[model samples]
Target chain A: MENKVLMKGNEAIAEAAIRAGCRHYFGYPITPQTELAAYMAKRMPKINGTFLQAESEIAAINMVYGVAGTGKRVMTSSSSPGISLKQEGISYIAGSDLPCLIVNVQRGGPGLGGIQPSQSDYFQATKGGGHGDYHLIVLAPSSVQEMADLTALGFDLADKYRMPAMLLADGTIGQMMEPVVLAEEKEISKVNKPWAVTGTEMKREHNIINSLYLAPDELEQKNFERYEKYKVVEENEARYESFMMEDAEYCVVAFGIAARVSKNAVVAARKQGIKVGLIRPITLWPFPKKAIADAASKVKGFLSVELSTGQMIEDIKLAENCKVPVELCCRVGGMIMSPDEVLGSIKKLMGGAK
Target chain B: MTTEILIAGFGGQGILFAGKFLANKGLLEGRNLSWLPSYGPEMRGGTANCSVVLSDDPIGSPIVTNPDVLIVMNLPSLDKYENAVKTGGTIFVDSTLIKRKVNRTDVNVCYIPATALAQQNDMPTLANMIMIGKVIGECQVVKMDGMEDAVNKIVSARHAALKEINLKALKIGNDYKE
Candidate 1:
């Protein structure tokens, strides 16, 4: 706490990524996330790291793919439309089982939407943005401190699971400044990557990193093996935060900025004698299903608050197995739901439950 | 206690900088705080605003929809956010730039000729600092003791001279009357 400094969430993510031993950064300019690339552009050179502003989002993700093949921690970031452009490379990287970080400081978008905070990319990020059955370990940070912590965590998770990880943030968190106690600078020891395409030195079989499989059965076996790894990740790595859930009758489920807003509403509702709490999912891909399922037994209903038109509500419903009534409170097209608006929703949920 | 402050002005009026300064003061005091700016094409040459929340407890939403303290440096901002302040909240207006009187009678309003004061003090760009000084003096959200330290933390070493001028402007606004 003594060493806390005020930093924008985007800058915190960049600094934490550097601290996490990421040496290669490839990105194109995009609003709400441009500060991240600008930070990397300024710092990467002094540290002798690679910072390339690729010609396009596709080029940037492919650059991430190349560096990831070398088994080094590399990352790229963008807003919504740009993130859509990187999906193809993301699928390829996942197919190769490469470890890397991807950051989406999302803005409003179906296509070229306004540059305002939005979580409309929730489905795209959590349910596979690219083709093929693959998952990115998605981490959502609701605050600037989490922004830094999750960037480091994303790299570690990616390395552990041998897959790509994402920091799914929004424009509000990306642009906001807050006090953050950054992780201390420690000696970063490289993780042993035997599958890395570093030269073999003629001592062992050559290592090949590729997504292309000519044989259908070989690809099927590879997909099966990857799913096995994913199963372990889902079991062990699902993370969430429960707030004021003790003795609560109604629950609000949200992530990223929506979770922050929902927290306020929960507090207000509690003041008004409504036993409502919050469940904030930190890992979106491994959606915190267990938490919802467990809370379903106690809570009367669940309110899914989001910055999109009720995208994460489906996940909440599925998680709770439709045992309890689930409702959606949301705003779309880069608009955020105010705390009062969310409080109104919470009160409505309470009334409907009665 | 939580104080949500909304500062609005023209793009180059140092609205974000003032909010950052206030956020840093809260940070230095070890209080939980968040500073969020309205970022977009409008920031090029149009209205800009920032929301700063300083709190003793953990802050939930960073956005300040109904601010406890509202500071408007221009007329449009005053017109837009005048009704958005909490009923018992305070509004600080830069009278030098905005000529209209506040219409709301439910909230406390302070009109400071911040730009004129900054000009008379030979620091024209220090108007934002002046308004911030008034905010600190009136709201008492942050103490005046660690201002020098806060300025040192925000201003880079290369612009060391700004520390002196900014402090002077803050003192001017803090001591301003009528």
Candidate 2:
């Protein structure tokens, strides 16, 4: 029987990783996301898994790098500032073509901004925060159920593409509680990684996994190869959900917690005689441009709702190729956008009647 | 049907727990639900609140701007959330803690006096359940059986001894007159 429980988003994500055969978890404590590490610390040992609390975020991510090198399912999570610290390591993981899971339970930020929900890391997660020509398969989950499901998906996609995948969530989603049915416990050998650096005694030669190359052309060729993999991911892995969009004249594009809130606003707007709908991007790195372009052809305009000022608006406009004006509705620095505010924006777009 | 509830009070008043109870009951009934708590440094010494949504259809926004039912256990919570209840909605106030009379006549106001009742019963921390009882009795937002199931799931084994008392407190509030 499947396990169903009422869980916080953070706890569910941790348990999902465990169920997905992720035995090694290394992380440092941070607000709004501390429960995740705490759950791992308590459960991993009981499951005969390894759970380590590193001295710093930098060390934890590097620990993930070490474990991922062994071809074991491994992951680390942190909030905004801590993620900033892990960027260098994340880039190295991407460059080395290693597979692993990274979770960013985002909080309001520029620097030490606040321990509240925010999506300010869109650019960082999608455009590559770590300084490199690479992308993380960014999955934005809107609910606790998605938190669990997407964590498993992140691992699968990471292994499939040999790249890092991120579960990009916000503080609200992390801290929120909802019912989630955890996936069945998966066997450890879901992927047979051939390039893992196990002891060389049984093999013909020792496998070496690294991101460094002595020759510039060698590094450039490696970059091109990684990009080729990324192109395949972009083509096949872009995921999104469209709601009430079949007859929509205007669409609200959002993700994670913002998407959850915008859904309410869309329902309310529809009841008030406005033909509004929602387009929720599940994969932020691939950006779901095709979905946006499709909606642009049918909708009168678009509204980009986010917990940040306007980070995702750029992606939305680019996806639509500036075919229609994409309006911005947002709340930043720990404040969340309310349904009334979003409905107000839709009403204004419909000439301020409803 | 959709019900949005906001429960607010001082940090130790189990305000978040009450919201959790409702959210769990909703989930147990196979309804769509969400419970969003306000997290920040204010959690240590300031007021705490949580928003709960129970809907027959898929819930869109978990953030409740105007709640169908507002439960405030302190004067500050009452002052902060009084205007956020929808017109003709219900507002449950802990009258023992909130001395100020509610000014709005547009909504249905039930002064539960949950704190005094819990103190009288020698269960000072059970006020939230009393308020929950009153909410369930007045609104019938969830089935009593669902609440019972939720209580069993939410109360850990370490606190198993307190379950009966909590249930009794809920009964007291449910049987509350006026």
Q: Of the candidates shown, which would achieve the greatest DockQ relative to the real structure?
A: 1
lDDT of 2 by residue, B50-85 (tens): 999898987777888899999998888888889989
Q: Write the per-residue lDDT of candidate 2 for residues A124-180, one digit (tens) a residue.
A: 999999987999999999999999999999999999889999999999899998879
lDDT of 1 by residue, B46-121 (tens): 9999999999999999999999999999999999999999999999999999999999999999999999999998
What is the DockQ for all candidates, taken in turn? 0.94, 0.76
Chain A vs. true chain A, TM-score per model, equals: 0.98, 0.97
Highest-lDDT candidate: 1
Q: Give the TM-score of candidate 2.
A: 0.97
Error of model 2, residue B121, in angstroms: 1.0
Model 2: per-residue Cα lDDT at residue A304 = 90
Candidate 2 CAPRI assessment class: medium
TM-scores vs. true structure, each candidate: 0.98, 0.97
